[model samples]
Target: MTFPELVVFDLDFTLWDCGGTWCDCLRPPFLKKEGQFFDSDGRHLTLYSDVLAILDDVDDLGLPMALASRTERPDWARELLKLFGIQDRFPYQEIYPGSKVKHLKKISDLSRVPLDKMLFFDDEHRNLADLRPYGVRCQHVASGMSEELFSEGLELFA
Candidate 1:
């Protein structure tokens, strides 16, 4: 039976269906004032429900799960997770601002898990490309894509 020892996720686009570049709406407020930003559409996005369910299932199965993002707002990110009610599913150290490649490498080293045993899902091609050479299982989804990618990602770790 194939089971992933570690599952990592990229935030922004991969988790939010905000209908455009995830960083676009956030950059101005986030970079400038360290404040929050909600586009004209408001906070109307949600991750695929299956993703949450899968996290829960992975927990039940004793698999590890984490989030990795280049975002700097640790507080707000935690609040967002609270909004989604999945904050406890992840570890605090798993949410950090650095190159995803760096964070993933650190995670692998600290956990003593080989890169090949890790599964990473991101909506950006660049992130996947950078981590690919390290032997991490990486999947990249197109910007503004649909739930199909989430399904495919789950299958990789399933």
Candidate 2:
């Protein structure tokens, strides 16, 4: 039943899917329609089906959650997080364009938690690759975030 001190997730295709693509690809002026999120072009934005529950489960575990996204549009990402009503979930967010290694390093410094005690999930292999050398437990998210995938990540961390 061991758990990492912190859990970090990548945005884009990991925590959410922005119309089957990255959020940076979507046009601006994001909107909400009947509780669903969309862009000006009608591209839908949504947290992966299991995202909310997974976040809550992690919170229940008393582990702090953070977001690391190398998206070019940090403002849009933040807006979407607010639109989804999850802007408050992550106390640490590094959404600018850069290596994830830098993001995790900053999170480590901010939380005073070493890299080894953090578990990171990202859809892109290269992103995971960048953090692997720093002793961060990395999970490759194959099809967005799912309960099964999250469970496997916890097992790997343990």
Candidate 3:
């Protein structure tokens, strides 16, 4: 298999833990320090342990990355990304409240990468199912993006 032209990610559970709640939507902006984010309510939001390593590996492969998040609080998501200093990692982002299909379509159209040539990672099973018809090689990120899953994705698209 050839490597995908683009890789897309889901923001919330796939990247970071939002305390299993929408507390990420709270009023105050997140605090960034020591490589972690603390929400307004002092709830901790952290990237999966393997996130940086995986991202670095993907970047080393010269693959472009994008974000497709159906997060209700788009502002919060953006803020978190910025605080994490990963905002520039994904040049194409769609973080509105909508179906994953719509997000993937927009990313595909914007990046000019065919659905089949794109690899997507999301935490929701429904999202994986929804993207199948679009020909997107979707992977379910159960706990978060892990090295094993990342390798599987690489193999699938390699």
Question: What's the TM-score of every candidate structure?
Answer: 0.73, 0.97, 0.92
Q: Indicate which candidate wins on lDDT.
A: 2
The top-ranked prediction according to TM-score is: 2
lDDT value, candidate 3, whole model:
0.84
CA RMSD per model (angstroms) = 5.3, 0.8, 1.7
Residue-wise lDDT of candidate 1 within 101-132, one digit each (tens)? 88887787777788878878887788888888
Candidate 3 per-residue lDDT, tens place, 1-158, comes to 58988999998888887777653466566776686678777788888889989889889989999998887878888888877779999889998987888998888889898899999999888899999898889888888899999988777766
| By TM-score: ranked, best first | 2, 3, 1
TM-score of 1: 0.73
What is the C-alpha lDDT profile of model 2 across 33-136, one tens digit per residue? 89888999999898889999999999999999999999999998998898888999998998899999999999999999999999999999999888899899
Model 1: worst 10 consecutive residues (lDDT sum): 25-34
Per-residue lDDT of 17 in model 1: 55
